[model samples]
Target: MDLSSKSGGGRTGYNPVLIILGTVVVLVGGYLISLLSPSLFPLAASAEAGPIDQLFRVMLFLGGVVFVLVEGLIILSIVRFRARKGEAGDGANFNGNVTLEVIWTAIPAVVVVFITLYSYQVWVDIQAPKDDELVIETEGLRFVWSFSYTDPLNRLAEADTQNFTDSVLHTYVGRPVRLKMETRDVNHAFWVPTMRIKQDLLAGRQTEVAFTPTEAGRYRIVCTELCGGGHGAMYSYIQVYATEQEWMERFIDVRVERILNPPTDPLTVGFNLLNENAYPCSGCHVLESVNWAGVTGPTLNGIGDTAARRASANGLGGAEEYIAQAIRHPNAYIVPGYNSGVMPQFGAEQDEPDAVDGAYYVYMSDDSLTAIVTYLCLQTATGESACGDEAAIRAAVEAQ
Candidate 1:
């Protein structure tokens, strides 16, 4: 039972070749795993995405190295240190190594500090304001997103109004964007997966997010937070144009021109208003004309004919009156299968006195409401308007 003779005369030796091979394996394995990052994420469409993705890859590499090292050691120990057939007692009895403990502790502490500094720098760089940043006013309602933009050049003082609003966030490559976001009914989140930017839209206060588009493509914008039953339908897009000239010519100039010379046709204006997501209808209804596929509310496939029947059944004056009432005061007559109070009240006034205390209220100008009604009234199988005329629609909306 001489222990020294069994332990090779008590001389402890290290395997240099094994150490070098293990280090090489750890480094190579980590690098190989990091190479899969591009496939793991959507296209890097923003300037911020580059650094963010790099940081992710760094962490991934470190994680892969640790994983390989730990699992490899575990497997090696299981095979190399298993008890022999005649072995019976405890394997090895020794005090813990303080040096080994210190090495493990110091390594993790250094890694943590490095990661903290690296992550903070990335955040600071991404959040820093850029020159000529386009400021967009973003509103996140229960199941929709609306983006508003003012003419950056201030060329149209005649149309000194709030400029224009659209459902899509439009910009050009290399242009920085700052989104000032607010929520109408509940908490929501504004997220652009390709841009790698997300910000919360609180109920009462406003929040903002910034990013610079580095690519020209349409990127999906989604509400990552579960705000309501229609959260899944809360999505839009960031339309990044290839050049500033293309953005101005295609989107900005077109929208501004529409504002400068307002369309006289109520149907065109109404279709434009709804198509641009002036209201949150797309999140709750299925209207094929505007490509709305919301499942929360009843479909509006043949709403013109449906409105005439509804008016007749409910003893309303006409289809125009019924449509007006449905838009302004939805709970007055609920569709048979749909629940009441789900749709927001589109009041004519900014602050309607008759609006329910806790209900969602959105302002709709008399003109816009009339035009919307007129447009919706044309959704019949016969391609004819169920409502009488423009004046009649306005009168009906006013009567509500």
Candidate 2:
């Protein structure tokens, strides 16, 4: 068949004007789509969020334009070169154009270079630590987050149990805050959607991320990394104060009192610790006294009596030993109906490497563990002698 004679116009039928017009249409349509995509982002509350959103919008526009151009060309070729009626032969035959290939390849290379430089700049700006930046040390465990605000003069205060000074992350509006984060067990990401900052918490090393909150509101702190069974509940709140005075009055002053006049009573100490959400117990147990309504684990309404009796039957020391064993080795004795691996190992390190889903890393001291047990042992149904006596319980706690 004579393909050139059939077309009559020969290769001139390929219109460069039409190709240019189509390219323009795809580019314009893609840009418009990108501009509209910023609506998908949540409210921006941090200073860094503005630039981050800007970069995102730009990338989205570029991506949309490319998508439209590629798909448009594919559809155009399909329709323009479709098989004609009664025509059963090759439409056209031409060798690949090296010039066109080179042009397309060079275009993406240039675009990639621009994107790399722009993204690197944004990264540098967001991570640059500013003067007077408040430092918050963050530790991510199985299903809980611990924040420690260290005193500048006494940097070693975190190791001092008597101080009990380290607490939640609290800041004032416009305050530059840097978080030195690490994971106690597995990998976890610290994310604040409104602030538009996210970083991973890695084990054995410290990672840092910084942001300046611009709004005065309570923001949700989420663990984007899937650590384990309680991953869904691994969240906390960041309270941004309106002013420095307000922040000092609310957070600083309270933390000061907690450190200087630390609670001495064992029961009060245990209650305060539990109520502080330091541990992930409330999410798995139901305790009316503490207003915990979680049903993930056995009810703690009368666990003291049950635990003490179980300890005796198991030939363990007493309630304290039973509770301690449970925290360190949750799967040692599973509840009748509940599963064995439901709870995390609160005070133990991960034995196997990279086995994060079922294991965790927690830095729990004997004193702290005993205090938590002391608190749990008092969860009596009728407020009777479920843990025997104060002297006996103390003896059990101090024995080992």
Determine which window of 10 residues in candidate 2 has minimal summed lDDT: 1-10
* Cα RMSD, model 1: 3.9
Off by over 4 Å in 2: 1-9, 13-20, 84-94, 141-144, 151-168, 183-188, 202-204, 222-235, 280-321, 336-371, 377-386
Error in Å for residue 142 of model 1? 2.9
TM-score of each: 0.85, 0.77
Off by over 4 Å in 1: 1-14, 77-97, 184-186, 202-206, 313-315, 333-342, 351-358
lDDT of 1 by residue, 3-121 (tens): 11223777655566767888899888888888875588988899999998999999999988898899888887787778999999988777898999999999999999999999999
Indicate which candidate wins on lDDT. 1
Query: Residue 11 in candidate 1 has what lDDT?
Result: 60
As a TM-score, model 1 comes out at: 0.85
How many Å off is the CA of 280 in candidate 1?
3.7
